[model samples]
Target: MSNVISAKNLTLAYDNGRKEIIKNASFNIKKGDFVFITGPSGSGKSTLLKSLYGQLKPKEGNLVVGGRDLANIGSRQLQELRTHMGIIFQDYKLINEWTVAKNVVLPLMIAGYSLDVQETQAHRLLKHVKLSEHADKYPLELSGGEQQRVGVARALAKNPVVILADEPTGNLDDYSSNVIWDLMENACQQLETTVLVVTHKIPTIFSLPYRHFIIESKGVYEVH
Candidate 1:
């Protein structure tokens, strides 16, 4: 499979270039692969992810995602590139007013799926995440784990080609975190989605295959 995300000689910084995060970084994530970006806090793992989703532009070098160059895309074009990606944040970016099912189906609705199809897929995804019983509950009414599962359901609603997760299980218990990992692995295997997760700590033992990439000394290093 070809590269779904490619970064070459990439650099990301903040504060008007006063702070440099990733400098001269290069990496490639192929289609249908499960990968992890691990580093200490403030090492720019999140910034690198932002570049992939076009949330942050590279300060230098080339960053291409889904075959589109992100370093210089217009606003509308960046939005178009994002349509091919699903993002999961640590805080579970969900509307408190919306029920779990509604939250899960938002992507489908935005994609203009019929109400009937949205209902069907939303329910199916909820069931997959073991949140069927909580589908009618609002995001605030559920625990953090449940809300994260809802986020997972929402991310999968669009059948995104690439899924970007930022500390998705950061605040969850072992059970919940393991469940989330299982769900992600299953999605990669079943839907062939390229999954990239940014976290500070990855379990020492894991069954699913994944590449381990670390950021340190102002660069990205893929562990062999």
Candidate 2:
């Protein structure tokens, strides 16, 4: 199987003079695979996700995603690299002033797609996430779960090769959580998108069949 992400002996630290959160961590995500990243509150789960998405550079070791060497890539290249990736944050980062369709179209606009084309894509994705009725509503008017559904729609709008999610179900109830997971699972199976989720929902994760990676005070481990 081909690999979508590969990090070798990766070490990550903050620029704020804090201690290294992850040390000598290495892993690979094969194409079309779904993987779970879990750890204690401060065990570097979010740090690892940021590094993988190029928000933070590795202090030591090589990091590669989709055949691009992250360490050697320039800012322009990093932006381009992100075109093949979709990221979901714990807080639904939807623009409060923008309508649901407009929020979902943000990525497409950044990619310089035509407005009409973005509209079509946005509508399709909103329907996919079952938010078609709220297409004209502003994010602030939606519930937390409804807003998160919009986030998922936005994430998948670009048809990215990889999806990175950080605490995607953090504030959701059981029904909403299951809905979000189903959308993510659909993305993985139907779009051949590799999924890397940083979440603390171990009980839910334990029931799913996915490769697991755990980060602790000691180091990173690939758990079967």
- Candidate 1 structure quality by residue, lDDT tens digits, 85-128: 88898999998988889999988887788999999998899999
lDDT of 2 by residue, 1-224 (tens): 99899999888888653678888878888998889889889899998899888998888888899998887889999999998788898899999989999999888999999999998998899999999999999999999899999999888989998999999999998888888999998888888889999999654543346888999983889897
Candidate 2 has an lDDT of 0.88
Taking all chains together, each candidate's TM-score versus the true structure is 0.97, 0.95
Query: What TM-score number comes out for model 1?
Result: 0.97
Reference-based lDDT, each prediction? 0.90, 0.88
Q: Which whole-number lDDT from 0 to 100 does residue 72 have in model 2?
A: 82
All candidates: CA RMSD (Å):
1.1, 1.6
Model 1 lowest lDDT segment of ten: 200-209
Error of 1 at 1 (Å): 1.6
Best by lDDT: 1
Q: What TM-score does prediction 2 earn?
A: 0.95
